[model samples]
Target chain A: MLNKIKRILIELGGIHRFVMRFFRELVRPPYEFKEIIKQCYEVGWKSLPLISLTGFITGIVFTNQSRPSLAEFGATSWLPALISIAIIRALAPLVTALIASGKVGSQIGAELGSMKVTEQIDAMEVSGTNPFKFLVVSRVLATTITIPILSLYTACVGLLGAYLSVNQHESTSFVVYFSQVFEAVSYLDIFSLVLKAVVFGYTIGIVGCYQGYNSSKGTEGVGKAANWAVVMSMFLIFVEEILIVQIIQGMRT
Target chain B: MVNEREHIDQHTKVITVKGVSKSFGDLDVLRGVDLHLFKGENLVVLGRSGTGKSVLIKLISGLLKPDTGTIEVLGEPVDELDEKALQLLRLKIGFSFQSSALYDSMTVRENLEFPLVRNKRHLSRNEINSEVEDVLDAVGLLHTIGQMPSELSGGQRKRIGIARTLILRPEIMLYDEPTAGLDPITCIEINGLINEVQEKYKTSSIIITHDLACAKSVGDRIVMLLDGSFERGGSFDEIFDTNDERVKPFYDYNFII
Candidate 1:
């Protein structure tokens, strides 16, 4: 047991060193600015349709389900505040992260995994290119920058969808609904969701790249890398969420 | 420093690999392989399957590090340089992959322009334009310059690969199975282009191939690799005419009449 733990610790230490070196190589000269922009579009902007669809429907479903319970309390007017808190502080970032873990994580993992097997990465190395910095760094940077934007966009659209759903039954104005939402949401709520999204982004990027960069064997390895990327990233996000919620509650107290 | 090392000088040998060996776990690929490349010489390494010819070119290009020994490119110790320094060195060496390895997402122009853009300061836009155009023309793919790799034929893609490598105007050119899978006509076309490019640019070249026709056509000196080492090497005539027991079978396999 002790030996197993020792091996795990050593592996973790090696990965930590590699990540630091990745960051260092990432920022130095011979920037792949074009590649970065291209990846940002490929990984980030392209997925807006799916992200928007999920966000809107989720908010609509949540509000519709909660309406009957609130109606019993004669507090149907509390719908906007209730839905906004649920969507922004809890559902939006977490669900967006889950979706992205499947989408971007698998994409990155498979792409790098294939490159590794085909010796394309080796080609870059021989050509005197920093494969880690040029390939991994650009990807990590793109995901880190874009995921938060996705979370914010999803949260806003989700609230709009909920407001519209609520309007299908209640006769409230858009102004009244938004004011209640703003009033109910505190700075802490905003901070927590944004914080979760950032962590989710980092988790997805790191785990995906790790799987792809270190993959072995052959064609089957690419699929394995993609599969592991999603599985590991989703698991990490949930684990992170648990710790973050506890830390946030402790800070509030 | 850049201009002086742009091409080979008769006085200065370009690439020197001394006692290089590499292995994957228990499988030792290259063992004690040493070779010298002069300025403006075409050196072809020929061998049967699993002979480590490709491994030799890769090590010289700093793609793979040797388990032991030294590789000096343009007098710089390649084994000692960091990743950044290695990339700088790569900018001076151009490689053509057998599979073409063109960025699939990019058009042919973008694929060719990629190394040029990355190494931007070396040449101006007009210079890059003419260089790309000239390279495309030299490879006889001037018409497909706007198409993506996915759109091109197998032969056409390889030609684009040649164009991409030429954009860098490398001092040392490495070809990994440059004509491996093409049709016979395409194979001959690629071989002729390889020779023409070497002469036109005055670039020293190291070509790895199992194709005897390619080896004979492109090689100024032919070296045969076998049993984890070089078995025989000489000028084309010396390699073909010699009747040594080990060397005779190779020519016989090619059905040389």
Candidate 2:
């Protein structure tokens, strides 16, 4: 048991070192701008359909689930504001990140892990190209920059779903519903959403890259890397959410 | 048992490994191995499976470090060089992996163009295209330039792998089992290509292989790696006549010449 604990600590240290190296290399020249743009298309644009679907469903389900309790208190009219705040402040960003942790994180991990096993990463290094910059830095930067945008897009789609769900029973106009949705969301809510997106994006990219880059030799190792990338990223996302919420609460006090 | 030091011309030494030893976990792969390569010579290191032939080449390329001793490539100590310095040195030395290691995500043309664009970013698009075309044409795979690595046969992938390295016009080529896992006809073609490449580019090389036919045809000098160090070093004919029991098994069977 002690040995296992020691191993986990050592692995954590390795990941910390890997992240430090990534930041150091991130600022160096030969910035790989083209690769970064390509990764953005891959991580952000390609993920739109899935994010949209999930966001829409989350908004509908959460609204439907909350309707009975609100109706009991004769508060059905407050549905738009309640749904909008919940979706924008937390659900949209969290759901988008979790979905992306499955999609983008696994892809990055599997692709790089296979590269490492096949020696393509070594080939890049031997050919005068920095593999860390070309592979890890580009993907990480793309995720960091794109996830917030994706979350914002998801929040918009989720609100549309919530509006439609509200119209299913009540006779609220489209304009009134949207106005209430906008009125409930403050700059603080938007800022927190964006902050959470950024943290979650960074976590996904780094964990995926670290697992893939340090993948052991063989086919089994590649699978393990992909699996670990998803699991660890999801775990970190929840941890980040708790910390950010606590900090926001502290500021409020 | 053989003194290979006399064969090296000190002034023209391109790579020198002295008393180098390496181990992974408990297994010692290379133990105090020493060797040298002069300019414009095909030096082959022959060893059985997992005898650290690949490890030696990797050490020279600075992909792996040794536990002890030194490897100097083009007069710079590879172990001591920083990442930037090592990357600079790597631009001059091309390594063709045993598995080809072509980027599966990129097409053949893109793979060939990677080194050129990274190393010589100033070249115009047309210049890069022509250079890519020329290297592909040399390897006789110009028509397949647009094809992915998965689309190519084992032989074609190997050729494209070589073309990718040749695009850089490296001064030294380290081939790790270049002709492994190919049909006999493809093997001969690759060996011929190796000879042609050495002559055309005037590139000194270290070809690591267990293929006796490849060693005899492509090697100007052959060294047998046994135990940990080089057991013998000489022309193929000289080593073929050796009475050493360990080296005899390699020549016991008649190989296709």
Candidate 3:
């Protein structure tokens, strides 16, 4: 068992070195600027509608569900503040990530997964292009930039949805609601939310690419890549959330 | 048998593999395999499944490093080149994958544009457009440019894969079973196109395939790989007519009167 564990560790280290070498090659080279732009559109901007719609529903449902519970404590007036902080700092990015895991992550995994199964990645390398930089890095960078933007957009839409939900019960001005929400929010919450989205983006991008990139067997391997990506990325996102929450709680105290 | 590496060098050959061996754990895929790929020559590599044909071509193209051996592609040792150097070397080589391998998300044009986009070979939109159109014309797929790969016929996709490689104007072309899954008619057409590309571009090619028809039709020289090495290398006719003990059975199995 000990020897087996050692072998696994050695293999993982080799993979780490391999991945890092690819990254080093990626940043230095003849960069694919236009392709990167195209990927940004595909991975980031095009995903806006789906992400935004999900965000709206999440915010509306969350506010409506929490309203009765808060009213029991007669804390209903703090609804705007509560919903605002929750949506912007926690729910928006988290929910957006989940949605992206389903949408963008799967798309990336399937796209690359198919490419690998087809020997297209090998073709790229043979043709004198770094597959990692030309394909993986460009897509990953696109996700990093795009996911946060998508998250911010989601937060905005979600806030609007929460406003509608709150207004359904009691009248409230947009200005007063937004002001109260923003007032209750800290710089830390905003920064941390953005930071978390970045991490989520990285997690999704890396896992999706990793699974597809290393997939060896054949046809069903691509499917396995997409499956493993979703599973691994979701786990990482939740774990990071817990870590982020603990750090935030520590900061507050 | 003499090793092919002794006679080849930077000037005489475009690719040379010396004392190359690769293995997966206990299974040795290639053992002391030595071969030479000369410029503007069509070298068809024939082998049964699991004979390491794919692995050999991949090693030449620097996709997988050999466990122990030296690979010189376009005069530079593949193992010694940095990523940037390797990328530059790759630009000079075009590879057609067995499965067409078109980027599923990208349209045919985007798939063809992939390598060009990296090299930025064309400065303006008109130039890129013209080049893409020219290659598409060559492959007889000017109309399929707008369609996604998923929508195309298998033959159409394979043609697009060829067109993608042509966009680079590579010095060497490596094809991994270009006609493996195609119908007979499609196979003949692809074989014809492969020949046309070789004649027109004057680019050295290494075609890896198990299909004997493809080898007979398109290969200038057929190299049969068996038992982890090249068992036979000769002109297509010599390969067909030779009475060499190992060559006779395979030739008889595939060759028609």
Candidate 4:
């Protein structure tokens, strides 16, 4: 148990140092603008289909599940507002983050890990290119920029799905459902959602880069790095979710 | 093998690694390794697996820092220099990895163009295209320009890797186990290319390998790295001519003579 705790501490220190380097390199000149744009396309555009499908399913299922509970209280008409609250304020961000943590996180890990083992990263270094700035900084910056946009997209898709589920029973129009959603959510919810997505994205990027950059022992290490990237980022996302939700709640109260 | 140190004052030293030591946890990879490379010469550091041959060149490239002593590349002390200075120094030194280390996602043209685009910065598109074509043509892989690294065979990838490094036109070349996994014919071709690169680029080089034929074919001076530090140095024939058990086994196992 003591050894495990020590190991965790060491890993955390490694991540802290990596993040510090990212911030240090962040302000430095000769920014890799092209690479960052490419990564944004990878992180943002490539993730859309998965995010859309998952968001739609989440919305449909949650609305169906909550219907019986609201009916018991004879408050079935509150379905739109309640579903909107659940999906926008919490569900959308969490689902988007978990999916990205699996897809983008593992990808960055495996890609960088393969490069690390192959000496491609070292090749870049010897070629006089700043591998960290080109690779890690570009990726992290991409995630930070894209995740908020993805989260917003997820919320929109999820609400549409929820509306479909609602429409099946009540024959409600799209106009009424969207108006209810807009009424239920506030500027605070929007701010919190964006903030949570940014934090989650940063966590995923940093964790993935750290694991893969430090990967060793060849092929086995690549697999391990990918696995750890997903697991660690998901864990941190949950922790951050709770903290951010609490802080927002505190501000509201 | 004779412990022969030849005339040193004739040529200028481009890289000098003195009293360098490195350790990884309990393993002592390099211990008091001292070596030098003269300008425009191919020096082969011959060592069996696990003798820290790769670590030595990595140290020279500033990829890894030595725990003790100093490494001077092109008159700049690698250990003492800051990151920016180290980066500038690294541009002057080209390292050809054993794995070739070509960016797997990039096409051969893009891979060759990468170092140039990053370092040279202000070169016009026409100049970039010209330089990329020149290096690819030199490596005889101009046809593979459009193909990704994954599409190329081992020898092709190795040539492209050398071409990528050559794009920067470095003053020094470090080939780490250049002929490690290739067939005998490919090894000979790679050795020929190493010699060609030296002559064409006018670059001092260090080729680390265990292949006797590679060392014999490409080395101007050969040194055997045994048990971390360099044990002997001289002409390939002179270094392997003795009955020393440490040196004799390598010759016997490789050539079986």
TM-score of each: 0.91, 0.97, 0.89, 0.97
Better of 1 and 3 by TM-score: 1
lDDT of each: 0.84, 0.92, 0.83, 0.92
Cα lDDT of model 3 by residue, A1-253, tens digit = 9999999898688658756865785678578787689888988888888887888998899999999999999988899999988887799889888888777787788788888887778777766567888788887777777888889899999999999988878688888888888999989888888988998987888778777787767868888888888888899899999998888788878
Tens-place lDDT per residue, model 2, B75-116, is 999999999999999999999999999999999989999989
Which segments of model 4 are wrong by more than 4 Å?
A1-6, B1-9
Interface RMSD, in order shown? 2.2, 0.5, 1.5, 0.5
Write one digit per residue (lDDT tens) for candidate 4, span A1-253.
Answer: 9999999999888878988999999999899999999999999999999999999999999999999999999987899999989988999889999999899999999999999999999999999999999999999999999989999999999999999999998678899988988999999999999999999999989889988999999999999999999999999999999999999999999
Q: For residues B2-46, write the lDDT of model 1, one tens digit per residue.
A: 112224465767899888899987999989988888888788888
Query: What order do candidates take by lDDT, descending?
Result: 4, 2, 1, 3
Question: Which residue pairs in candidate 3 collide?
Answer: A127-B90, A128-B90
In terms of lDDT, which candidate is stronger, 2 or 3? 2
Off by over 4 Å in 1: A1-14, A30-32, A71-75, A123-129, A216-218, B1-11, B240-250
Q: Candidate 2, A148: how far from true, in Å?
A: 0.6
Q: Tens digits of per-residue lDDT for model 3 on B1-257?
A: 21222222335689899989999989999999999987767889988889899899888877888999899988999888887788788888888887877877789888887778668854588888888899999999899889999999888988898889889898889898988878999999999999888877778889999888998787767888889998778877766566677667776776553
lDDT of 2 by residue, A125-236 (tens): 9999999999999999999999999999999989888888898877788999999998988888899999999999999999999989999868999999999999999999
Ranking by DockQ: 4, 2, 3, 1
Query: Lowest lDDT 10-mer window, candidate 3 chain B?
Result: B1-10
Provide the lDDT at B14 for model 2. 97
Name the lDDT value of residue B46 in candidate 4: 97
Candidate 4 lDDT, tens digit per residue, B83-176? 9999999989999999999999998888988999989989999999999999999888899989999899899889999999999999999999
